[model samples]
Target: MAPIINGRLLFNQLPNGLPVPGKTTVYDASETIDLETAPLNGGILVKILVLSADIYIISRMRDSSVEGRSSPFLLNQPIDNYGVGLVLRSEHSSFKQGDHIYGMLPFQQYIVMPPATAERFTVLSNDAGIPWSAYVGVCGMPGQTAHHGWREFSKAKVGETVFVTSGAGPVGATVIQMAKAEGLKVIASAGSDEKVAFIKSLGADVAFNYKTEDTREILAREGPIDVYWDGVGGEALEAAIDAASVGARFIECGMISVFTGEPYHVKISFNIVTKELKISGFIVTSLHQAHLSHFYETFPKLVKEGKIKYKEDVTQGLERAGHAIVDVITGRNKGKSVILVGEE
Candidate 1:
């Protein structure tokens, strides 16, 4: 098979002289990716294998400043985010040729980076006996988001009751199992019936179809949630606020529901004050430095022992990345949506 280049690059301005719709464009780079021509001054070159499409990218696409966080993707350049890749050539001794690793990579056929720049992602191997993609899913940033959201902030205790929004997504699925592991009764909500059933398979005590079932009614029936792990905000958040226990802890991770170019109408501030809920917003990047080691040490065991399971809707080839990104954000993806950039 011939090598194919299908990555997309984003720019700030369109050809018509207006600002780029959302800092995006698609171009072919097959001939432009010769390793001989790639910069080799003092860094490693990685060939991405599996790249993830995340909901947060949707937030970036809409040109909104999400909680004052700057766009990770820059204008007039390829975007960058988490990707699993192999070091094809390296100036650094530690990252020699053929080392499988995962971390943020520019959206191109290959990306050069100083080994010292980003934190090194632990290499995956058959010896570890888990799919490499798990590093970017249940055992990766999304996993840590669920873990820290429930454990550190929510302070969810054994036998307590917890509710998580976006129950079918990557982070949501992990949160359900992790909550169960800690002996918490978990209830989760998703937009589709299939998602509701999938979350139930993941051991959620109660799973509801938020699309058809009224979140307020469901919460009223489920009731007195000790913790509200919110990955989707808006009306669901309002319902969570209304049903929270007296001292409920509301963990705000990512708000996927309202990220599109629409005015936010759901208001839960009054409920927050009256119910005296403890709400905290968190970014996964903030904990990357502090908790990186913990994720590496624990993720493998969870996969090997079957304590955790992951689902992925894989879209082959890099050209599919654009649609895949939109799918994940719109909840069209059943689990984590990944673009397979290369073969195993």
Candidate 2:
């Protein structure tokens, strides 16, 4: 017998700031599907096991028409992001009942994808020896973002000094460690003292709380930086521009400071020409195929050997997903924000 599925929907659009609780509605539905009687036409039904709560989802909530990305969630539709799930029934040749998979999925308890969309799902290997949550995190998109941002965008070389902002967050944390592994001298900045220490423990040569210190002064003292991996924009980006060495590469992965509809005015435009710096902005989706493949092949080995480390700040239950997203955007989360939707 198929189980009843409860789903969460975005009840309203967030025009400016943080998400409100009532904006995400939860309701029970009577819809159910029997695996035996399900039609085999390249469709698949999955039981969602984990949902990733990230600032990127917040960006989507603010505007539904973000070009080169998934269409924004409709007024009453379920929010979608990366998720891990178990196949309950499958009509696709690549998947079968009982298979675990990861892909872009909704925040609901169960989902049905038609033939065209079903191709987005990828089967998870049980022998991978990593937690499912890792698939939505370190071993997933964030990991790929870090790897490709450094290798292709930043073009960091051995012994060069690199600075990373929001170093305690998923992508920044991975960037810090990967830079260290490749023999780069790494300096990291975070919002709080605890987060500063966390990045330091991950092998950052120097870590500081940007909240308490002036980023410009800190970078001036520690820099002449060859590469800058920017996760937080606004003031941090201005600081990087001012502190960059000649021919430095600035890889812009995100701008969390302005994601909540805050007004941002870039004040360091003049420095770009004066310093001969190369600035590039990237979305992980553009480099997904090559970087994701390289990350999967290499990252797990580093995780097993203790050369890389990751952390997930998980909130239990799907209901807390909104709160988790708010917490991560506001710097309240200590690690990667994740919603534990089911038992491992």
| Local distance difference test values of all predictions, in order | 0.75, 0.80
Per residue, candidate 1 scores C-alpha lDDT tens digits across 1-344 of: 34445455453332222122243545445344556566666778778887877887654543333354746444566656677888888887667788888777665666677767534655565366777777778777688787666656878789989999888898989889888998999999998998998999999999999879888887898787999989887777888888888889988987776654464677756777777899999887777676666766776788778888888888887666666776776788988887777775
The prediction achieving the highest lDDT against the true structure is 2
Candidate RMSDs in order: 3.6, 2.1
List, in order, the clash count of every candidate structure: 0, 0
Q: How accurate is candidate 1 locally (lDDT)?
A: 0.75
Provide the global lDDT of candidate 2 against the true structure.
Answer: 0.80
The reply for model 1, stretches above 4 Å from the true place, is 1-24, 62-67, 115-127
Runs in model 2 deviating more than 4 A are: 24-41, 63-70
Model 2 lDDT, residue 224, Cα: 76
